[model samples]
Target: MTVQPIVFFPDQRLRQVAAPVVAFDKSLHDLSIDLLDTLRAAPGIGITGPHIGINLRVVVLDLPTSDAPEFYVNPEITWLSDDKVQNEEGSISMPEISAPVERPTSIKIRYADLHGNIHEGEAAGLRSVCLQHEIDQLNGIFWLQRLSSLRRNRLIARYKKLGHA
Candidate 1:
């Protein structure tokens, strides 16, 4: 597994919707491995296909409290709790100060496994956050997109100023 370069914010490609994973092919498996490698390098909980410029509906996640890597393909949130709370959220692309955003307390998600088997499960806490973050990528949305327009603009400017845009 090799670490893939992360596509940072302000890149228009980040705003493009990812395509669904059609089959469990060699390339798809390789992408998943690379995503795990990249996520480990980021020292973060999750990584999405789009972040590595793949534009396929795949994500790799490993919470700080967990060691086993989790993979999701064409994942969809099937349910969400009404209770919500605000927390500081960060991203591989932004790599800036974590911005506070309100998100559901829990979510039930469905996705295909590496072997092309469908699976559904509930996730809370960091896993939930990771799921929501990665799912947003599948739809061409970022965590910062949940922020106010002014704040989003400011963050983009900051990234540009940092020479990462």
Candidate 2:
């Protein structure tokens, strides 16, 4: 698997909604492998197709300390718990910044595996947060947008100051 180049924040393609993955074939499998490799190299827990400018609803996640990586195709949040938690969130696109974002403590999601097998499950804690973040990217919502305006501005300013914006 090759490490794909990541599309950074402010790229117009990052704002485009990803198209659903229709075919579960060799190419899709290859893309999933590339995503895993890219995310691993980024040293990030999660990544989406848009992060690499693929424009397909694919996500790869390998939480820190986990032995295996997970791949999701066309993932959608089906339900969110009323209880909420604030977790520090960041993006590979905007690597230099992170801020606490309030999100549901638990989420139910529906997605397909690389072979097009449907799966539905609940996620909590960091897994929940990571799934929401990556799915948001698939839906054209950048993680920074979840931040308050003031925090977003501050984070962007810091990124710019670091010559990464």
Candidate 3:
């Protein structure tokens, strides 16, 4: 597996919806590995295929609380709790910028595994936030979309000040 170059923010690729993963073959597995490598190299807790310009519905998250990293293919949120929490969220594509994003405190999700088996699971706290964020990327909604326009603009200015477009 290789660490693919990240598709930075403002790139149209990050705005395009990722295509569904139809074939769960060796390529998909390798892509998942590459995503994990890229995520680690990017030094972020989460990343998606769209983040690397693959435009495939895939996400890899390596949370410190987990024993190992996990990959999700074609993941979709099935249910969201009414309880909400605003946590500081950031994206690897838009580095050096983050804003408080309010999302469900818990979520039930359905996704395809590398082997093409469908599974359902639930997550809460940071894990919940990460899944929601990555899934948004798959749906062509950048994390910034979750923020208010004012806050989003301010962060973009800060990102520009940091010498990144």
- In terms of lDDT, model 3 sits at 0.93
Query: For residues 77-161, could you state the per-residue lDDT of candidate 1 as single tens digits?
Result: 9999999978788888778656788899899999999889999899998788778988998899988899999988887787788
Error of 3 at 132 (Å): 0.2
If ranked by TM-score, best first, what sequence of candidates would result?
3, 2, 1
Relative to the unseen true structure, what is the C-alpha lDDT of residue 88 in candidate 3, on a scale of 0 to 100?
92
Query: Would you give me the overall lDDT of model 1?
Result: 0.87
lDDT of 3 by residue, 127-150 (tens): 999999999999999999987899
Evaluation by TM-score, superior candidate among 1 and 3: 3
The Cα local distance difference test for each model comes to 0.87, 0.92, 0.93
Q: Write the per-residue lDDT of candidate 2 for residues 1-165, one digit (tens) a residue.
A: 899999998898888899999999999999999999999899899999999999999999998756799999999999999999999888899886888899999999999999999999999998999999999898899988888889889898999998986
Point out where model 3 deviates above 4 Å. none
What is the number of backbone collisions in each predicted candidate, taken in the order shown? Answer: 0, 0, 0
Question: Could you tell me which residue pairs clash in candidate 2?
Answer: none
Better model by lDDT, 2 or 3? 3
lDDT of 3 at 57: 96
